[model samples]
Target: MVDCPHLRSIAPMKTSYLALFYRSWPRLASKALQATTANLPNSFAIGLFCVAALCAAPVPLKAQDQDPFYYEIRPLFENGEQLGQVYRFRNVGLIQCLNGDLLAFVEARHDVSDHSEKDVLMRRSKDRGTTWGPYEAVWGHLEEDHAGWKDPAPVVDKATGRLFYFMNTNESEKRLFYMTSDDSGYTWSDPIRIPDSLLRPEWKRWRNNPGPAIQLKVGKYKHRMLIPGHIVTHEDRHFSVVWYSDDHGESWQVSETAVQGSDEVSIIELSDGRVLMNIRSHGELDPGLDPAYRNFMYSDNGGESWYGLETKRDLPWESGHGSLAKMELGDGNLLFAIHPLVVKRKDLTCFVSYDEGKTWPYKKLLHEIGGYSSTIVLDNYDIAMSHNHGFRGEHGIDFVRFNLSWLTDGKEHANPTVQPLPQAPESKATDRAIWREDFELADRTILDGGSTAWKILGASNAPIGAAVSNGKFRTSDAGGEIVWQTGRIDIGDAKRISIAVDAIKIGKFNNSDSLRIYYRLGDGDEKLIESLSFSSDPQEDFETYRIRKHDINVSGNQQAQVIIRSRINGDDKTLYWDRVEVARAE
Candidate 1:
């Protein structure tokens, strides 16, 4: 071990309330200030007051009592008991060292941008991340590097007991760099620019993965250090790639392009000595694909080649980084994934898969608002996910500690199977029309004078490839699936509800192809109203078919929503909806 001036060591404590608040000030600021201060003139003062109140209160560390415990590493501003950093923290990179200590790093930035001025800051947790030491700048600290630094992807070399850090800098152009720490992150070497041979000069832009890299322990290329990253082509195409170093970070080689139309990937070595890369689908960048779903690819020969590229429909990923982790359970294995659940980067949820990323049957919400996450399973088996705690990472980065028992509610879903679609009950005789969408005129507004209107599903507050034109509504042409949902409608005096849609299907259909309808009463869950198989229809081009359900249960004077969605198994398919109606039945 070498002594360095940047490192500051703090004594380990079983539980320290002050220590927790000092580091978790950003968490308090986001959670408390949003709830308490609405008309308050100065939110910054209110935030400080809340911090002081929380630290003074005798709050116990509920590491054992509460599952999925949360704590922030750095705060945006200096609070009553904390010293704020020079810049806010984002893009967290975390890993568990060989000595059982946790090394965490974040991008200290004035704003959250790829080219913003940034510095890499780090903190250590000696007590399994119960508490962490203060922040010390690893790069862009002592030197005045005007250009920005980004994406701290750290890896621990088990054979040499050395820690290798990989990051990118835009000093002149986007370039990759590395630094090393021989003593469990106590000291570090100066930043060394990665040679053009490893990064590939032809690639216009290359970025390191925001999460921690992996070192293979039980594979054909055991002890190989692989870092997941993405390079952009001059044509604006994004592809995921891996850089592997077999000699313990001595030399690195760039693997073949992992997958196209994807970016910001996280990788984990599977049980059968293969690497699985979880990709963030950016189909919008490539017009041929569908966006907003988590994609996967396998590297059977240890990052040398990639194949089996497919999208997991169960995981509805919007547009951000996610963490993929493998959990070992009594002779069997389960893969856990952490990402945002909705169309936006909010509601950070954890999805658990029992059959090696084929399907995800178990999931739980870890945080309300989240962005850009990294996860690691500790030696004791508890999972810690470090992520940006804000909606779009405007606040800062925070890590939540949880376990499988907490995520799955202490239950094991062995041999989990996908639940069959719910069948629509037989319809009774019905009469009056409560709501209808004839698609005669286009209404782009989400709501038209308090009455909900039919709108296509979208991301980042903009509609996708769907439109209402020429007396019909057309689904996206990019394939996969497109969902059309109506806003809440008040079903006044109607005891039972029914929905019907008349549409013409285009392109070939498969056995797995389907058109589904769902209804949600009040604030309850969305229940499936009907599922119609396209294969059952007669083979006729441009033939119009009507799908209807007439016996949906509903209460009077309660708000309800009607949803119509379509999925194509393997080919491109579009739905031209001519008419849709939600009627009242007696």
Candidate 2:
């Protein structure tokens, strides 16, 4: 058993230094002038006294003024240590059972990578997460079976008091499995596979998305159960879709591809019975989409069809899994989102949206370092959440229970107005050029997935034989091949970063071919900053190259690298780049 600690005590609340400086300086200066006149010469004594008074001024009370509430973050899985053995945990799922029990599940792996063999494990908390019990093996390794199980998406059908644990086996075929538990989570039915006819014939590899499943609670399709899923196309592309069950768990139906070039979706029902699906767009594969944010779509007719695919920039995320839930707390219903709010998989923050998914004003950092989180509204209306707390690949799945008051920082009754995001600082003429390349140096060798100064990666992301030809970086001869990756160039910190490159298309270029610019900060994942697509007609003249430039605000990162890539469609089409540069703006 792990000891749970209240968040208020463990983490010191941050305060506004500028507010305190402005409020206390006047009083301190008056006191300093009064004490200095009698002690020494007015000018020197006042200067000495003012320095002392400034240091002695009392700190602000904003942190103490905040209304404190009870919250606990309990460690369930730490560094892959459980059941007297070591194994990593990932792909979290949580659900409140009909009988008020909180059931949590995750994929326990021998290692953190996806290809590692793993088991699906569960834990239960009957007393509203005050205490959690030992691990229960729902599906896992057998002597004859070594196939891995991943992505535990659990849903509770409140009307029938049945719990559905949805998951999939990770093998070459990738089969879907489901189990029902009537007695809360005490026991589960034998793992059963969905029939082949229910799944589309083209979906050779279908997997359950990591998060909680939703059961619609309003309108004509009330009580409809929907869980997000995605299928890998024959060309290795992914599309977000939904698996819905109208007749409870007895039968299930698949929905049309809601968003193409997307994966790992989570669905929430908004007011007026519209189902909104938040998606993880395929950034590297999907041209023109900023990978820093997630995409969204809505379905008015339950999960049968979806429309209006749009990107929500308010959700600050970088291609990691996120969970969404609508909280019916107190006077209004608030939409709750939990995901990595930074470019890296750190700062797993909770965002509260008053106007559905339009804007999020209130937020709380649940964990400073987190990954792949799932949230569920508890029986008492508090949020019971779980996430992978370890940095990078190490596994530390911890659970936390918090309420609306704690999440909103005691501003539960405050006006629910949309908070405008701060605009980027304007650039000035004083901005400096940080890094630039003209490919003017002697030719250098480029290798696939190598440490060479330059590399041309093929579809497999491994370096193929290539060289910087004629003072320019050139992509592979094989066009329209899946993905083409170029080597990285380092750029220092900046308040604003701009990436520019001169490019020319050669041979027969298709409309689908695109050039993308990405940036990486430290050890974090590469984020897609901007993308440029080639024109329908290929340019064969030497003077036809055009400058493609993109600017973005990245204030505090100490180091960054610019990653350039190209997605082409057919052979013989290639893109050439020269005069690449990265600069800092005012």
Candidate 3:
């Protein structure tokens, strides 16, 4: 640990907070300040205030003061490149065997689509994820019978030390089946069908989207293994349920519907013995047209019944699959690995919650361009993450090995030579009376008399991809917002203000969802300036939007700045802004 000269004079709490601030201050201070302060005046007083606030913030343990950890990234499987025969690898499931070996399982698709013919593939890592054995087809179809084995969910029996890998076969008769691995994933037993009586008659036709299973470590249901499963009831309806095996997978009983209009759930037993299930909502069940955040429920009866269903507004996520696991370390912290965007599958971030899954105050971005992910805690309190990343021309399922120190202490642990991907440039307005921003610059700073960068607000998440690219500044997919300051522009002499820009939907266009714009003058509250609703254009393309002088209301204000916001409403529609021109009394 680095010796701190000021430790002697500082209090215990202040010392810890200051140590973390000092370690990350030099490198991350600029970005952190930019993200937190956008509305306040850019003066030395505000700068000092921000610094003081940061110093007083609660700090995690510093990396130098903590035990050393290791991090490594390796491709486990890739699309079109695993074996000569397998074309796609998806639906990752990881488990540590009884013999301390790591078993990585995935769906080997004959084609890229989910409905295509698939099989269960496995690889064993004996040395704590340092290396892997060759691929093994655990289950597959010999002929084109249109039957496929998908969604592998594995749970180890603590009492028997036997691994049970559960899966569902989608054929003329959809059925739940499982295999047994006695020798640490070296070999497996033949698939045995789960009793049809375990499922309700109305749930027979449901398709299972499997996720991680956990054994309750505490409470009355100790050692009970619960496998999280989801099924799509209709095109726009889905629900999450669990299968409980009290006898170590000898027989199983399905739980009642835990959450409605939700799918792809991950459950974790909290320190209080309550099981919390995080689910992906389908939006059809909520009043909101598109639900961007995850829905959660708690079970007190060992996965038998669920209650306390609520939307996690703090955790902003897209309508995609994510993984959650409980860290066996201090306070039994919960770690969530998800695509951090609202409507797109990107920015794979790991969030840590100290008080179970209630509030996630710590986060780390693991991959810039990511898809479905599964997380597993290693034997040594380290973390193993497997996810699909398509960045730097590497498109496949990659594994990342890291520890709590690397995640919380802001230390570089793995492959220090490899630099992280550069962040997208911010969008800043020019300082001229007739200011114009084409968003052609790679920096997010506005080129007024003094350059000022746009700051993120309301949410800590950044834009999904390319905030400023191809001569445009794109809005985020998840209804996040950003603000840019114009400094002290003298527009008091001018009668009216006008703005013109080109806008287009990034993906599919929806008329109900539109980009909203607002403006504030000299520290006043932000007022609505323009609302550029999507037009009924048959073709999905860009259209010019002009805010005339009458639409702009800048009365008795000498200095003003613009605030651009949009709620994509869970649709992956990105609003692109280009050729933004602001004028006075034009």
Candidate 4:
């Protein structure tokens, strides 16, 4: 149960050297590739060779390679186990310098209790990230550096403002450290150690791993610095390599080719530079048991010859950790960040690509399916992700500011001051129903005689639901308890609300039949909002009703809440809620 589908690689799909390098071209595009659930074993023991050529299969080009979505993943950082020493900063990046003037990099992690971390901060946006300037510590976690520099990949050599922040430091064991700020990032120089032959000519049994950054797009490959190195956890040998440098910082070469899956490093470069090295193959079904999905190998000789390994390409990655980014749209058109549409119930969607990573077709959700994300590149490119959100002890780091046609051509720009919202505040567009309260949204009540007692296990209900972790939804309850507490109506200056509800409980009593009110909107599985089951009345002693003007849908401009669920006798329910209204029915 702990593995509904989060990261399961049952095992059994042996072929080694990555399925003999995609079975060596079985006659042009035979679909693509994804058959390694896993059984394990065999390397140079060759016999599967599949390349199948890979062109003209889906055949549909132009309009930015037939766009869709998957453009640079983002989920800055979190903690309870991954970011809380008082909660350091975040891991952001946006270095637009061919000469456009914008610098954004934030890694920061100095929360000491002995998870063994040290300061790794940096922040400076100039004018791209909408505003940022309190994060100073351009990657330096050294007392003697005991381990803790975390994720980083800040580049800005658009011809020398000279700044680069490549992280994951520890000095004697968990290697791969970098930092170089000539003055644009404000200040810094100390931590530099990206040496890596892979560290083991025999150094007393090494230990190092933390890699993320394959940013290219300004000169492509023969030396376009495509770096993506990882081998830092989950019991070593998860192998992730893709290193290339053409003397910008000076010397590096490991073109990335040692694949086994379990986060085997992705190196995104498309924008004419073309460098997509995404590798992850555990087993189509069984082996060491950890290969639920993802597999690829394409190197037009850039990463130094990768003869096309394949898998039937089309992935909304139902497993975790899959990110890629590339943006250029001024009408130049080209945006991507695909594969991350997993769902156990929590937010984990990354689909949106105007053709670059090859294909995603359309999507841009950071975390609404659950866990892990990080995508930042702003300064008119407008895309700042950061997800690891709600439902896992209330995970934090969920901020979204989007564009690129709202994730590749779904085209949405109507926030021009959101007006079509007036479900209540008395305009009588139908009956004045606009309402907005800072009650953190949709759930917060506690009473007895006027009976309104809800604790759907906890967090009163500002958006709470988890039939015990199988359905997934919660906005409050538990120590920080306050799941819901907002019933004050009338919202004017226009905010957000589209109403319709039914579902409540508060210390049941009287044995008379006759009650029905149901609601489920917003957590309706990634549509973002839509679910309203209605009806209510048990003679109203308190657990109340009213808010069905045809169920709401008022998308933002200020204030919004529409969540209601009440069932009796079915799951043994007790109810509450009253005449919740909204106006401007459109």
lDDT per residue (tens digit) for residues 1-586 in model 3: 2223332232223333443444456447656666667665679648766676776465533323323533456688767755547467777788886567788888887776667778788888986676789887776632212346788788787666777888876552246767787666776655666766775656644444555678897879998998887655535466678888888777788888865576678888888788998887764574532366777889999999888877776677864777887665433455554555633577677776767777765566666666777787765555777876653214767877766655655333322221121232332423324565556476443233434334445534444432564345655554344443344445666656765545545355666566767666667897776777675543322233444333355666676666676666544455565555567644
Of the candidates numbered 1 and 2, which has the greater TM-score value? 2
Q: Each model's C-alpha lDDT? A: 0.68, 0.68, 0.63, 0.42
Looking at model 4, report the run of 10 residues with the lowest lDDT sum. Answer: 468-477
TM-score of each: 0.57, 0.59, 0.57, 0.27
Residue 218, model 4: Cα distance from true site in angstroms:
13
- Say which candidate scores most in lDDT: 1
Give the runs in model 3 whose Cα sits over 4 Å from its true position: 1-69, 81-84, 144-146, 234-236, 287-290, 330-334, 391-394, 410-586
- Candidate 2 per-residue C-alpha lDDT over 207-278 given as tens digits, one digit per residue, 9 for 90 to 100: 888889999989999989998988887777788888888897888888888656778888999888999888
Between candidates 2 and 3, the lDDT winner: 2
List, residue by residue over 1-586, the lDDT tens digit for candidate 4: 0112422121111212232233233432342322331333444212222322233233422232311321232233344343223454443444544334445444444553224465665444454343445545454322222355555566554433456667654433345556676655565544555664555442222222222354354553433555565443334445545556667676666544344443434556555655666554432322432344455555664565454554424553454444556555544445444334545435455555454545655443443444444564444445565544543313434334445443433343212211121121222234444542212223232321222222332343323322211011222122222223223233444433355443333232344323333333333321222332323433221222223545345344333334343222322333333333345454
State which candidate has the highest TM-score: 2
- Per-residue lDDT tens digits for candidate 1, residues 175-259, read 6777888777887655655656665656777778888999886857998899998888777788888888988776788889866
Q: Which residue segments of model 4 deviate by more than 4 Å?
A: 1-105, 111-122, 127-132, 136-235, 241-273, 276-485, 488-585
Output the lDDT of residue 364, model 1. Answer: 69
Q: What's the best-to-worst order under TM-score?
A: 2, 1, 3, 4
Better of 2 and 4 by lDDT: 2
